[model samples]
Target: MTKLTGAEIASHNSKESCWVVVHGKCYDVTEFLPEHPGGQKIILKYAGKDATKEFEPIHPSDTLDKYLPAEKHLGPVDMGTVAAEDEGVADEAEVARLERVSRMPPLSQCYNLLDFEDIARQTMRKTAWAYYSSGADDEITMRENHAAFHRLWFRPRVLVDVERVALDTTMLGSRTSVPFYITATALGKLGHPEGEVVLTRAAAAEGVIQMIPTLASCSFDEIVDARRGDQVQWLQLYVNKDREVTRKIVAHAEARGCKALWITVDAPQLGRREKDMRSKYDEQAAQVQDSDDNVDRSQGAARAISSFIDPSLSWKDVPWFRSITRMPIVLKGVQCAEDALKAAEYGVDAILLSNHGGRQLDFAKPAIEVLSEVMAALRERSLDDKMEVYIDGGVRRGTDIIKALCLGARGVGIGRPFLYAMSTYGEDGVRRAIQLLKDELEMNMRLIGANTVADLNPSMLDLRSLGLHTSIPRDHLADQAYDRLVPPGLKAKL
Candidate 1:
């Protein structure tokens, strides 16, 4: 039987509209109705219609012929003219999730996207929150992480009969819902009892790739299974002192269907987190043998470091990691263009720009600030064209995403915010948080008259008011980008 693609279903359900059916899934895109960064005319064409053809270029990873047929066969979307009460709707994706995740109240309530902090506070101890929430020597990077968005106030052009916006984009030759990577985090159980398992569920549902941490409580096989065989999972490796053990872990992740491997190079050693340092929290160090249900922090900070980390590491070990995996290799902590280019030289598949949530390095420029420089270099070698480039730091709004995208990131990732949401609500909370981010991204996209993330160019920005001087050169600007932007603690509210 012939079935309708998500776009066809959406078109059938709504009157006439514009929207992106990213990776064969549909989104409402109504709330982000007005703020498209692209001109209204282009967006309106997509209103109530599927923009799949528009998406193909950005998402080159999938073969169009196969996806086209599958999406159609998924089901028929009830075309227009049904009563309001009709069972009229369509379907979709995202994060890792254990089928074990609770769909009920305390669990369900935690699913809200807006309760970012509440969830973190709920699931984590005050000390854990301090450790997770606080950043660097003074948290400047933390503040800039969200504040960088203000530098680019979107310029929305009007009167073109706007209707829809497309959110699909390519990342390392793959399809994804948004141009945002589901950046990895430590100890999924810390956010919700479901831990990495629940995160995989969220990733499956949301259509974003999951970057599973090396320290995940659940085994790699467990995480892969929860993805339900419909996910693109990756590994986030922390090069440890034990090269053999580290290689083993990387090999395990690859063996378990992981498509990419992200080696975090920024912390040859962990950063000094004053917030965690000042807290009453003691670290668990490691799990009690044979017990799957409890964390023993009795050994305090000493053990926490032991269990949470593998200290002996350096860039020299990149070749060792390369020898073990056929999957894409990404470096997770490139703060500058130099590092990004270096990763390219080392034959990495991608480069993820981050400051480790200000967790590893203090006073570093927020990742967003240096995007222009990194992107310029990426573009220089055609590496940006072949390999993926990502940024993660102080990203809280769609506008921040736009700035980075304009500067040339294949995509961006959010760590603390989603982790905060997960801590509070579990899978549903993560869903909500991701949705909110998508909404914010769509809103800003519409406002600026831009359709794709790649359309976000510096020309759309008026950095002049933000104390930006064109003469200083992009390199210098990237270096000082965070200093000039307002912090999330200040006036800018996404």
Candidate 2:
């Protein structure tokens, strides 16, 4: 690879000819301008200079490899000859934050998932915290997602030989060390510099599956390539309005050896997340609307990028998705039994009973509450075994996993807690979180008198109060801990 002077690279900065340097390597992204997912304006901002800083945080290392042709790889640039931009003064607020964080307890002191959330809230940037922690409307469903798990009581079988419990399981036919996989969460860079790649590393090390989010800061190939050996990965697709774009994305994931395609069925339109919305609700958005570029990125992170998701996605499109890839198709946000039967009718492989972690519809039913109804509906239609079922939202403990499995869930997914862990302590935090769940599963399974996940049955759980909507006070101390960690403007309505 021939090294080019920085001056030579800078000469190609125009819409007609754009060359940007990332991590000391120059690439001619001239033809890729229109194809950029974030819109061409973002690339144009750093058109003539090193975009490493701007690109590194939001993009996976393999983004160029996945999107650019081999011919566009224009070798390296000479850093010695580069005219460095004026290093601007740091934000005073940021300095104060770093100083504050320096005085806090170390990551090792953080014991559980909720502890990680508290640490992440203190350490993360305000915008990031708002985005990760916010829920739709009054956040009733978010509270319910956690509370519903507590409603179900475990019926521990006595006098059963409970030695040697196995936490390992298969998700969508892929082997995982734990029954739970790291469910998809978007804009991971908002929490950590490495973004979703941090999750990829952690999942691989911990022997679990990682479902890569379509809106991830890291591109699909980057997450796939980050796998250690044959570690499994699943792709979570937020179908683009453009069918051609959807087709290409599906093909790419399948080609990259993704084990399954988990299409998000909710989010036809993004929910009004007050916390995220309020972050940019001030006069800045209006001021920026009149800028040279017509792009309005000020609507906070969620609204800014969610514009591309297809509102027309329907049951008809399921067949179209099936045609595009050989990977198993799973609907990610089925909230009712009727929809669960419809999913079986569509002949898809699975459905994750979820409400977008209560980030979507306010006061939506928790996945666990709907599980019994979905199972009964499937059984009536003789479709109970036709499609595998899973649940997510407020899964903090192995006991939560046990409850879902007892109710006929093939597996479970966990999202926000892992994000908080990643934000607080990076990969090590995630690794510890996974280990903690395994330890809990071992102990809980023994106490519940289940040696294997298969040993868990509906009879083993007392679900008489599961269907009730009444508030069940389980752990006020943990609730208060999370309450303190909530972002300032957003109040928990539970």
Candidate 3:
């Protein structure tokens, strides 16, 4: 219950006794510095100052309370006497960024999901953009996620009554307005201040489900509280190393009325996203000692927050998860048909065919491609109807959603596009993005002579070229968002 002046906290700013202000409270993090997953440098930079702005985007509000011992909670600080940190002059890069923001095209101009990415790349901060946009090394899978869709040409039917097309569909026993839901992506505050709650509100407006991430900037209750009446939300969980912690999280989510539990199975360890690593290298490398072997300096933001994920998670744990919560269990990262079969045998409610948005493994087949193989394998075993199947990654257009549905997907999940939309224009941006997809879905369904989601079939697609990995035309909008890797020596020149 102690209330200390800013100067008192400022005096203990050295490595021997460091203190930082976050959300008007003072925390003595000196002892915890060496164990920081982000490396010690970032904390040292804000050693004696207010780190609220830098802290809010990447960390949940309960982070300090959960990780730090109660003794480290040094109580509130007197903000009236706090020394105002100097606002340094903006560099040329910042000036250019501001100019781009000023010139950002109107939201009405964002005709499709790609348009949001184009604007986000030009306007977002360098670090934020890097974290959100970067995929695994070489980013081949990331590009291929969208490219694979182009290979499957649509077989539009003619002379059929297609008026009054219906886009309504049910996912995990819940009826939704559209066949696609806003999928989970971490660090929502990195793009927008309100974080996951922004997406929650947007999803409610669109009558679609929102999957809240395990590493969201906002607390779990904050996002759950943001839901409107009967607005369903699912939890995307990264199982923690501590089973007790994971169990508690599951119980709390179920108590809060979460409709499903999406257990992410792909990321045992964070993938090496070069673009994101490069963005943090300069800031982190100089702060740590070569003798200090514990800190991993190269992982950037992804590594910092994901240290607790249980790499030992396996099929054996399925029964344990079932015991914890009755919310429908979904294996979120099954890449191959074999794993898909295994998931079905385990009696999971669903399997989300994804490669973690191509962020986990480079060269991993796109989710759309995997969906075809899995659906075939499931049908062969008479297990296709046993559980719902969903796919995410590179789902941008309404046609993309149609393609997945035609191939036996109950629904599709779209992640990055919504984040990009929210990043550029807040909740309104997210609403517009969903509305655009709805428009495209209706028009495409009508064009393909499909009156309802049930009308979509594999027969409506030309599958001969779906498996071919041939050269395709360049994707200009995607290319614009991609940051080409630069050699270390050339980094300074840029």
The global C-alpha lDDT for each of the candidates, from Candidate 1 onward, is 0.62, 0.84, 0.89
- Predicted candidate 1 versus true structure: per-residue lDDT over 1-494, tens digit per residue: 45335435345333244444444445444433342322233334455455544333212223233224443323333333211223234222111122112222353343223346643543355555765676656776677666565655555555533367889987776788888867877655544556677778887888888888765655566677788665787888877665677777777776777778888877765655667555523221122221222333332222243343555565777787788778888888889888878878887888888888777666677676677677777787787766677888777766777777877777888777777777756787777778877888887788777767666676776554342423323677667676653211211222
Deviation from native of the Cα of residue 450 in model 3, angstroms: 0.8
TM-score of each: 0.65, 0.85, 0.93
Cα deviation at 407, candidate 2, in Å, is 1.1
lDDT for each residue of candidate 3 in 150-266, tens digit (9 for 90 to 100): 888989999989878889989998989999998989999989999999999999989999999998999999999999999989999999998999999999999999999999999
Instruction: Flag regions of model 3 displaced more than 4 Å.
Output: 281-293, 473-494
Better of 1 and 3 by TM-score: 3
Query: What would the C-alpha RMSD of candidate 3 be, to one decimal place?
Result: 5.2
CA lDDT, candidate 2, residue 226: 88
Residue 129 error for model 2, in Å?
Answer: 2.0
lDDT of 2 by residue, 1-494 (tens): 66989889888888899999898888999998776645566677667688887676556677788679999998888977766766577588777667656655666666567777777777787778889999988999998899899899988998889878988877788878888999999889888988998999999999989999988988777678888999899999999888898899889888888999999999998887878777752223344333454555555557766878888888998998888888999999999988998899889999999999999999899999889899988888888878999999988888899999999999999999999999878899999888888888899999999989889999998989897886555797897677554322222223
Worst 10 residues of 2 by lDDT: 485-494
Instruction: Give me the candidate number with maximum TM-score.
Output: 3
By lDDT, the candidates rank as 3, 2, 1
The collision pairs in model 2 are: none
